[model samples]
Target chain A: MLDTILSFFKKKESSKDVAKERLKLVLIHDRSNVSPQFLEMVKGEIIKVIQNYMEIDEESLDIQLTKTNSEDGERMVPALVANIPIKGMKNAGR
Target chain B: MGEVIVITSGKGGVGKTTTTANLGTGLAVQGKKVVLIDTDIGLRNLDVVMGLENRIVYDLVDVIEGTCRLKQALIKDKRYEGLHLLPAPQTRDKNAVTPEQMLKLCDELKEEFDYILIDCPAGIEQGFKNAIAGADKAFVITTPEVSAVRDADRIIGLLEAHEIRKPRLIVNRVRADMVKRGDMMSIEDIIDILAIDLIGVVPDDENIIISTNRGEPAVIDGKSMAGQAYRNITNRLMGQDVPIMDLNVSEGLLSKMKKLLGFKTA
Candidate 1:
């Protein structure tokens, strides 16, 4: 698959490419350094935290540990972009 | 008393071995007594890359296990008089040697060699810890791709956590043509993503592949552009201001004169 992609555009499989590809995998694994089961457990715990207060809007709720790679700013942070539909009146929606 | 440099990348086959072999050779060629240690343990291959595979009888495990002394296991490079090799045992796994043992080995080596270059194993496993245990500084090798850049960033995080500051980036195997065609990520892109100081950039050369097979590092031949790049990196290590080669720009008369006259690249 990587070879296909390498051939697709242009092959920049140089040292820079080596570093770039390696960093991607490293970042993902470095976050937990554990198995997928552990990640699932963490995800479930996070969902439970949100579920304790109110019902989750499954479709709109997203809890992800995202990595942002900017020129000057690169970070690994958990993003909780969720929308919980409250069971209150229309005026109660802030 | 010189420095111990660990050349590492969390991803495998990203030229950690190649960088170690080349940089070690370059340092030795510049008259520095250097020892290149392969800390990969069972999957030992740095010796093969350095053309010292045939001479490895007492491996790293042997040195650690008290089967042989450190000096006895050190394989003197036949090509470069000042260069030495401490081959990893192909028989034993990483557990056979602990990071403390590796640290002791490097500390013992410090008195003899000017530079101790470690070819670190891939992944942040016990092997990686063993590789970086006694290093004074590190060079994180990476290629220009999303995955490699991400891995480099993670490795940088690990290094920082361990307090190994200023791990310079060595961008290897860069293809100038694709970069020019806007197909591949530019050096600027990789550096921007990693946000690290660039130490050197090596162009992807068929000669490196050929040299690996030949067991003769092309860095020995200054004619090869990749060799020149490695030499320049080593010179930079030695506090020389050797310029990075212009792999993309044509070495036309003007550029050649400018490079010769030590022009600061744009």
Candidate 2:
């Protein structure tokens, strides 16, 4: 079932879709009043700090940044959200 | 109720004043009382393009400074009875007028005209602030070029930041032939990028230069296809559900002309 659904959307995105995605990213950055370089620097610092005290596999970790509709356009308030895959926390508990 | 609309583009030479003049003329031609105010102090051109420079006994500065009455400064167009102009002070700096003063002046003008069109200066500074201080809406003008669109995007961002919504777009200098040849951006591409409602699309015509020289807008002449587009926009603004001019009409003309020229519409 998943294979059928995945194949259905495996088709390439239209040129219009590509252009809209680019515009959305640029507008998000512009509206948030934050530079892409600044976002990168922030993501790097937050990931580095999160890895220090976590019992998770760094290689299988993913950290993504996004904008949420807030009171202001975008306050640039960083959210330390991550999905870290724990390799063997149960085995370590023993 | 009088609606104040500002024609603004953050970048220079994107034809803000020209769009303001033409739209004002279009609205006036439709029998709506329209007054175009040039807010590009010390470098005014609405007066020049509208051909009312010599008739400007007073300007925005004069009204703000209490030197003259607002009606005294307004030069009514003899050609179009409903059209009026409030020229910018060519000799005074932009600092001569404050945003508050502009707001009050617009409030005064609102009582008189159906539409008060403000021609904003380029750049996002005090001049821009003054231009938008009292505007009920914004008509952003941009050419179908990367630089112009980018500046327009920036201007739209500023508007969003300032909580200015419902800002419509006017894509000027659009050459359909160039767009077909992939040399110019299409209307669809622009609207997709800007994410704004397309209000008007003015084609690049040599008659614009001639009309500017004559102080007559191209929209007055039915021969100019671009003029028809402006007239359509004016009708749309006046609470009328008029269809788009170029997209439907010009395409038919193009296919017909192409067939005549031994070219097929594929």
Interface RMSD for candidates 1 onward, in order = 5.6, 4.4
Model 2, position B136, has a per-residue lDDT of: 89
TM-score list, all predictions:
0.74, 0.74
A1-94 per-residue lDDT for model 1 (tens digits): 9657746554445654544455554555555553446555776776666666656555555444444453323334333333445443333233
Report clash pairs, candidate 2: none
Give me the runs in candidate 2 sitting further than 4 Å from their true place.
A1-94, B247-266
Kindly list the per-residue Cα lDDT of model 2 for residues B35-71, writing each as its tens digit.
9989998898998898887898998999999899888
Best by DockQ: 1
